[model samples]
Each structure stands twice: as C-alpha cells, then as structure tokens.
Target: MPDSDKLAIAAHLHVLLRRKTGRVTDTEWMAVNADYAAEVVRFARQRAQEDGVPELADWADRLDHAMHAVAPPAARRPLLDVATQAVRQRAVPAAPEPVPEAPRYVGGIR
Candidate 1:
C-alpha cells in the first residue's frame, strides 16, 4: 500500500482510539514509528476483547498487517530510457473532448 493510504488509516485509527478509549495519539508519528504503532495496536486489541467490539478488532488487524508488511522496492530505469518512454507516450496524445453545457434554472422550474 502507498504511504498516503497508510497515513489515512493511521489517522482514522487514531480518532477511533481517542473516541473509544480517551487516548490521544499523533497520527503522523504513528505512521513512522513502529514501536508506537505496535503499542497502539496492542491497546486496541485488548480494548476490543474487553469491550467485545469486533469492529475495533478488525481495524486493529488491518493496521497490524499494514505496519508489518514489507513494501516492495520501486522500479528503476536508465534516465534516457525513461525520457524516451515519456516522449513516446506524448507523441500520440488524444484530442480533448468538448465539455457539456450545464442546465440553467428557470425560476425553479428548469
């Protein structure tokens, strides 16, 4: 998954934790800090079990997998090759289509 997606999930989990357990957390920090993320995950799981809220447990499981999963390395190519590919893609650009006109209100009876 992308870093942005991870950050979004972390933010959501942070809000859920705060609302359910009154524990405030830094979403940005959690995204980068594995230890803090782990602590939060454990707390969430424990709370889920105690409160019998399966939804919280599900979110915790997602976060656990996202944090632990290894991200694949980005593909790299020669600068010339990349430039040639870009030029080739741009060589046959499609023509832009005309935009549709918006409907106008006629005294609230359009």
Candidate 2:
C-alpha cells in the first residue's frame, strides 16, 4: 500500500483508540515508529478482548500488519522532498486555455 494510505489508516486508528480507550497518540509518529505502533496494537488488542469489541481487534490487526510492512526510515522519502523534486523538474509552466465569449441577444424579447 502507498505511504499515504498507511498514514490514513494510522490516523483513523488513532482517533478510534482515543475515543474508545481515552488514549491519545500521535498519528504521524505512529506511522513511522514501529515500537510505538506495536505497543498501541497490543493495547488495542487487549482492550478489544476485554471489551468484546471485534472491530477494535480487527483495526489493531491491520495496524500490526501495516507497521510491519512499512519501509525503513532511511529508505522512505519525506513528502517535502518529493514536492521539491517535482518543482525543480518543472522548467516551464503551461499556458491556460482561452475561454469562449457567450453570444448576446440584442432584442428584449425574441
């Protein structure tokens, strides 16, 4: 999955965890920190079992898998870097298309 998708999942899980367990977590950190993510996953799973909420367990499972699948920090590029490279590569900007003028009626009633 793409990094954006993974981050989205982490954000969603963060909100769910907060609402269900009153535990606040940094969504961005959770996306990159495997150890923190693992701890969150364990806590979520334990709460799921205790509260008998299968949905929470499923989310925790997803987080666990996603965290394990993430690339190492060194291998991952920051979004700012990608944007900067894109900006640098664009040598010229494209001209905007011209808009057509609408026809005007002369008579009050036709």
For model 2, the superposed segments whose C-alpha errors exceed 4 Å read: 70-110
Error of 2 at 108 (Å): 67
**Model 2: per-residue lDDT, tens digit, 1-78?**
566776888888888888888989888888888898889889989998998877788888898898777466898899
**C-alpha lDDT (0 to 100) for residue 29 of candidate 1:** 82
TM-score for all predictions? Answer: 0.63, 0.60
Report the lDDT of model 1 for residue 9. Answer: 79
- Highest-scoring model, TM-score: 1
- Itemize residue pairs with steric clashes in candidate 1: none
Q: Model 1 misses residue 82 by how many Å?
A: 11
**Residue 60, model 1, lDDT:** 78
The lDDT values for all models are 0.83, 0.83
Candidate 1: segments with Cα more than 4 A from true spot: 73-110
